[model samples]
Target: MYRWLLLSYPRDYRRKRGAEILETVRDTAVTHRGTRVAANLVRHGLRARLGRPASRTVVLWATVFTLACGLFTASFGTWLTWLGSRPLDHDELAVAVNQLYPDKPVSHIDRDDPPSVFIIYGSPLSWSSASDLLLGDGGEYSLAGLGASFEQLPADSRPRVLAELLQRLRASGWDDTEAVYSNAYDCVPDDPRCDPATIPSNITVYAQRGDDILEVSINDDSTTPKMSLALTRSTPWSAYPVGVVAFVLGALSGWCLFGWASRRLEVRGPLAQGSAKFLFGFAMVMWWAPILLSTSLMLSHHLSEPHPRWHPLWEWLGQPAMSLAFLCGCLALGVAALSHRLPADQTLAHP
Candidate 1:
């Protein structure tokens, strides 16, 4: 374990000091010493990669860059995991819905075959949608799957009906948790007719069977009944480990690359350095803005609803939808890297 932890350090540094570090750890007899030493090694090794240990600014920027890169890699790994799983087919979803809610007949069934990556305008991504994805209606892109709209049940018996459905699900080999209740939607206090008490609360039940997840929602209004069932696939167990490993590797790479750029630009002329910084800052904005925006929206959504299967990490980061922005960020970063050069005086002196 000690020897493996040494890999956290840069290769050259590990080669020179790894044996000494290992020997010291071996000599220690403290309780839980391995855990403490492992944490210390990771912390110090990452810091050592940043080079200018005294510059807090470098550390801050490196951290931000690392997190963004880590999320991207994690999102990629998650998408790869999704590719390995099966999508809920139309016929299968119909059968499951019938078994789960026998008496509550569905008014309509909607089948959406989402792309392996993302859906644009309720369809697979395409060249025509490229304009919409970036400039026009990118916000419409969402993770969609099978859905069924059930005929409304009597308002008074809604709770009893939902309880029966939950019981049926458990008997059919589905694992479930307690039902979650929340306001159907935010009430408008200013409106004269908007009485909060009269509005029925939304009841949601979540269940999982193998890699599949089922969500049953009951929302009835004064004039009409509204209920729906949605089916989605769950992230595989392997994706967690894949995300963790990718995050560590991405963070390390981001720190080392940022350190290299910091050192290189330090000796350049003022204009070159300034340009590089500006471009890098723009790249960061392009990369991180969608993540921040999508994260807030997704967070609110999950909080307001009962989700047996959380959306993929990439959706929260607004990937594929913001693929254009990511590409722009990459272009800006590449330009920053390629444009930096040694000053003429240094070049002459070295030559």
Candidate 2:
């Protein structure tokens, strides 16, 4: 059960701190009732989600939670729409390319432009492999003999390492004439195009294989364009399971808080009821605010080419909002506690 509770933490965080947190929980459980232990577990779970100190006042926490909800709703809706519109696989790229180059023969394509002009076309997975070929230690583009992975070389060939190296250069951007016909291996100190130093730090590769015929362009800045592999597109069903779980957990939390509030008011009198209501409200806010803010930040960072300055403000607002929400909640709880201490008639009059 305790291990299950720890699952609420991020994976990296759990790996680093799970043992210590579990130990603390166990000690707390030994000193308190199981119900209290559960409550603490939940409280800590929420604090972790909020990315804030658990000791924060209630009003601040509530405000943060509300803001977070707003951010999350906006961001998630935007992401779902964007993802829906994006190409799912390489087939989409092939279709787009065919439409662009209708007159060109599909085979024996050639271009005289600099080696920097080749386009790379592949799936995301293949693109990752291609990147390793180009940028990994001893990659074709790397300084000679450095960062080499000899395992990448194919079997049954003399000068196998050299052949593998030349193949990468050809795939990267070297023209067929330059790669196969010319003495590409010959070191030329001053030849304008052939000079090793003249070669751009990055190269582009255009692929027209399988279903996709798109270009994977690389730049000196180390950013590579998205690559596509021609494969059947599959729906993102995995995300659906996660979304369902989140919806269920959110619903359960809301329900539990509502029930707790109802009991406090009916059985514990006005003060206790009010306090419980406030605390519950505050807890709800704290629980959701960080989640919403983080979602918004992540979406904005990944999907939109928005200005950098805007991101910090979004992240910054989260902290104060959480603090204010928690503070308000604590005030309400205090008011409820005071009401419980007073006479029933006084409680009724104040309420």
Candidate 3:
């Protein structure tokens, strides 16, 4: 078991002190139970790793590598989270639209409709609310073909652009004006008489309030439901995979630094070695503390109402916390290596 634990130390450490460490472990084992022996072995390894000084070249390179990896991993993870949370595909689009117009009767329009007006709605609250409604809680709807609609728009003509947007909306199931109003009104319950479904299908209404613009469909059977906008322009969040890559690199650097430090510190001494071993034991606690805390926080959040203010910070801390834990483990190993390096004079006094 001691030999196996020694494997956790740097290669130079194992080569230099493996047999002596095992012999000491065996002697210690005779005084304690197997579990305690195992624990002590771990403690010793950590001390050796921490007391050693890292080479300048190794430290510099390791630090650079760690930073690069951490940033890349963090960025990539953030992007993945964003992408995973965003709406996608036809079904996703349908859901988004439905949240925006809950009472609106949505149906796919036949592809034969002529040119028509299109109105795009934009508002941070509206977008957030709709996204939450559609993608967050209600999983029944999705956005599918909007990508194709935007792609097919004419570069030179405003009407063509309008037509394409309208066509995309129609395809996503906004075919009736009354239905649109009814859905909108239903969703916006504060509006007393704004029953979107009750609005006449043939009404040529253009309602603009603040940043919102509502373009009503004129024909009852136009097959595309007209849209109302609270705002006009919107941009999707771009996905970045670099952050995750960075996080991984940071962890690797930490590990290497830990090993280098361990090799340098594991000398033969009594008081010095014992102190290093104790420090290594303490370091182990620090290494795992964040992981335990974060896991507990996550569990607590899942069990209760999510406190919005803390969520972002918690997520941001995740990568760093994990990297730090890994570094701590390495530090512990280094400390253990240091503890094993007892001087000949001190060894006799301590023994």
Against the reference, the lDDT scores of all candidates come to: 0.78, 0.41, 0.44
Report the number of clashing residue pairs per model.
0, 41, 77
TM per candidate: 0.76, 0.25, 0.31
Question: Please, what are the lDDT tens digits per residue for candidate 2 over residues 1-351?
Answer: 888877555455679988998898888888789788877776665445434243345435444444444443333433343244324333343444344334433332222221221112321223454444334221122100001011211222324433443465356443322111112135557666676643433222333333222232222322221211121222233435444454455444533333333333555656554556567566555545544675576577645432211222222334322444434554654554343443456444554
Better of 2 and 3 by TM-score: 3
The TM-score measured for candidate 3 stands at 0.31
Q: lDDT tens string, model 1, 56-90?
A: 78788888898998899887887777667676577
Candidate 2 error regions (>4 Å): 1-236, 249-253, 305-351
> Considering lDDT, which of the candidate structures 1 and 2 is the better prediction for this target?
1
Q: Model 2, residue 318: displacement in angstroms?
A: 9.2
Error of 2 at 260 (Å): 4.5
Instruction: Give the per-residue lDDT of model 3 (tens digit) for 1-351.
Output: 567787656666779988987888788788789898787676656445544444344344334434534543554565445344433234444444454445545443222221111111311223444443333332212112131111121223534434544555556444413222122223456688666656433323233222222343323222333332221111122333444454666565565565564454454457664676576556655544544666677778645532212232223334333544545555765556543433456444554
